[model samples]
Target: MRKFLCTCLLFLLLSVPLDAQELDIFGYFEPQFNLIYLDDNYYQLQSNKLRVDLKSNLGENLEFGANFDWIVYHGKREWNYWNFIPERVTSRYSSARMWRYRFTFDDRSFLDNAYLRFSFPSFDLMVGKQQISLGTGYAWNPTDIFNVKDLSDPTYEQPGHNAIRVDWPLRAGFSLLALYSPESDWESSGKLLRLKGRWQHFDFSITGTETEWGVTDYEYPFVNLFTSHKRRLLGGDFAGELLGLGVWGETAYNFVGDFEDFWELLIGGDYTFDSELYLMLEFYHHSLAKSDYRDYGLNDWLRFFYQEQKSLTRDQVYCLIQYPLTDLLKIGGSTLLSLSDGSIALVPTVLYSFHENIEFTLIGNINIGKEGKAYGSSQGHSLLLRSLVYF
Candidate 1:
């Protein structure tokens, strides 16, 4: 893996443009190390990542781009340690040395995002793999309907999908957006058909989605319907250094036919003291109306729920603070607290930008109690450091 990565890097360097006007190459790399101290023992972990992006102009209204990612992992001396299991072991065995590799390539590959637009008064049409994000939370999307991240494990990362979206501008402050993603054989895949419109200060949307389970031998089809509304309150804009006061809220509900019903709500805002200091508060509620244990052949939903329930209620709270000392250095921290179970955790991070294409970060997460404890006592802590360079 190391030899292959070195060869790829050398080829990329040799392919660069000699002059300044033909093509553009941009990329970054991140390497990280982590250590955990628990029960009078210590464990170490290391990871390296590299990313590359290339772009060139084709002709009028046409362009080409490609992206690639390489990831490698190393650690203490042990075999088959990469198959991480949840809840069974809190720490790795001290003498396990492991190595793993992963590679990703995106040319916009199969069907590139090609489009042509004509300027005629006040309306336009766009056809391609455009980017769109809805909702106002770190990770909540009833209306998103497509491409939901799998956050259950830290090792798994999710990527976006290709879709066709359109934008139309009407008279006054009103506009409309519509999008669709045809089904394809991609990771975490889903199909979406949605419509959204904005009038004055309020925005409204309605969407329908079709999803197929990604797991093998247990796949099933399901449908979802979603709706959302958003409006600014008591301020001209919801962000920036404006009096430390503004309110924004959104609600989303999903109907999955005979499966299970899920819903989430988010309302929060931030206040900036100066250009370098800020504070943010948010409240989130998520709930499942019914369990679908029968579909998966589970004996009882509450039995499985009891074994997995870690919070007192279905609601959670998050508080965060950010401070910047210089253009190249910054620090931030946040706390996640479960309102129902009273379990809490803290995360602090520091970031340093060494150059335009190189950077490093150090982060720490501390849990303040036992695995299923009611308060802050039997917890564990982990520390991580990461570095990256782009070319």
Candidate 2:
């Protein structure tokens, strides 16, 4: 399928007349190295990623765009050490998934974006695989269902999804968005609706999403059960400035069939001083999480690591601080604390710019806690170095 798509894109590029339209080609190359220490074991991994983006205007009201990514991995592979566990695992469509496959697998290539868009006076229509980003939170986005942020690198580009999207501009600084992502049948498809506008001094959005979700239950070491249910999510987010500081809030209420309903909330703010020091803090709460770590079991740990669940604890806090040591170099660090279990993760980072389009980054992560707790001492730490060159 990837080969066929690449051929079609090549054909389009060749058939389109240069005089009629302008084609833009650009992208980047990045290589990253990782050294991890976990459970008294040291592991090394390296990955190189290359991406090429293509964009063109087909006509006055039509446009086409696509991006292709090829990545190669070396060192460690195959880390699923739970063969004794049940085969019943939840699908990663509706919730977050660890994305650890990138580091634990061989080389791969895929298309991240391939879409055609049409513009009109009243609304705009987009079809095929495209990028869908929603919500106002930085590290956590409760109102966003299409993609989940990686807490370690929250601003990285996300994989695209195949869907049909519509954007309609409304009167009085408001707009409406609708999206449909098909599955094997309409009854199990994913759908979303959002109404966004500015009120007073803040920008706000109300969003609703409906989809099917699957989860696996275990009965000790011998029995396992799998169940599917319809899940509905309703949420809203707001971002604005207050008293010389930037503030944002996001919340979501989830209703899962036959399962207990829950609410997730996040509140955050950031400020900068005259000395070029930056500070940011955010607090998150999960109503469905277990309040005691002693109640957690093996199944719960698997679910949390696989990203089928959000967190192992009920409450958490994230704080970040940054300062510029020189014009070409900057230093920063962040701390993630699980308020429920007294576990914490500290990450320090340094960034240097070699040239206008070349840069390097170094990051170190240290986890601290009891042996069996979340972000526990047994998890150890890791260091990562990444270099990027843009074209």
Candidate 3:
């Protein structure tokens, strides 16, 4: 770890020049409200946040940056909540330090990003906490091992990983990257390497990742989220135009320590109408899930909360459409269907732009399913209002 820190420091010193511009500081304020109905119960969340960012040039090639988020949220629920602690699924117990501050009741603050980066004509390097987003699948990303985003709220940015990344270009359409995310216990760290290229009209990439996950309380029940096993991931993705439609695919094969190997796959396509309307459809399958998992007891949900499992269903499909009704108003909607349990969730949204830097959105989520099916048991209906301001 010392060597890693020193290497980044050395590069910054060598890359910075004598003269550079002043630091740039800016951010935005956002406010949102949500109302959900589940089993005739009402739950709501009202949130307001202030984000501030600072970026300064160490020189022409080097830079320093950081961002902080302060949020205040309030809501009421009809039922009690569980899942205490923080970042149970992903956070390594043997991390360097806790980089957050919070009062879960109403106020929360944290430094979301802090990093040093060096840019060059041919290659670039970045160190510190940063988001690693890879893959092409819209609803599901089997190739994005570093980022496991929530399917319901797919566009939100999850927590960043602490790592050092080196990106180099091999040619006009070929490149590769190497990344290392170290932990206090080296054995639990993650390493990844990826290669990307193009052939004909298609773009493709192959990646290998090494991961060590810690077991959580849900796994052992009596224990904490600290025990885990090592696993290796081999994944690839491809995207291109097919039959006059945008087509993409992603797949990943996982090799666990002592368990049977499993795989995940996603295939999707999209089309546009006169550049005004867009439509997309996708299918995803997870080999690790049982095709007939009808025992929807508390234990199953516990497994999900404990990070001991992935999806509950083996097969699923998603469809979405977006169109602009006028110069200031737009509409979009999506539906997710779980093939295994024959459950479906529908979300419709509307966006209105009052100015270039300000916008408002209204969203609705509705779920339908059998008593013991995937979508069958959800917060029946939800309504949300989101507004954003940029400065």
Question: Considering every candidate listed, which one attains the maximal TM-score?
Answer: 2
Alpha carbon lDDT at 327, candidate 2: 94
Query: Could you give me the TM-score of model 2 versus the true structure?
Result: 0.88
Worst 10 residues of 2 by lDDT: 84-93
Off by over 4 Å in 2: 1-18, 81-103, 218-226
| TM accuracy, model 1 | 0.63
lDDT comparing candidate 2 with the true structure: 0.79
lDDT tens digits by residue: candidate 1, 1-391:
2244346434444554445225567766667797865444677867666666666543333334445666676774342312221122323222222222112222232222223232335554433343456544443343444435321112223343455555567655445555555443432244444445554454545555544422111111221122221211110112123344544555666554444455656666677786858777666665642222112121122212222212223566667777887888988877776565566777787879988877777778777744443223333467888777767
The digit string of per-residue lDDT tens for model 3 on 1-391 reads: 7467657765765656646646689888889899977656777888998888888888778777767889988785223212222233224333322222112445779877778888989998988877788888887788676666565567877666788899999987899999999887767789889999999999999989888754344323333344567878999999999889999999999887865577899999999999789999999998876566454433344444344555667899989888999989999988988888788988898989989889998888877665456565443678889898877
Using lDDT as the measure, the top candidate is: 2
lDDT of 2 by residue, 1-391 (tens): 3455457556655667778678789999999999988656888888999999988897777788989999998877555423212223223121223232112477989988998788999999987688889888888888776776767777889898877899999999999999998777887888999999998889999999998766666433334466778889999999999998999999999998887787889999999999999999988888877667665565666656555567667889889888998999999988888888888888898989999999999988888767556666656688999998999
Query: What ranges in model 1 sit over 4 Å off?
Result: 1-22, 37-41, 76-132, 139-142, 147-158, 169-175, 184-189, 193-210, 213-246, 289-313, 373-380
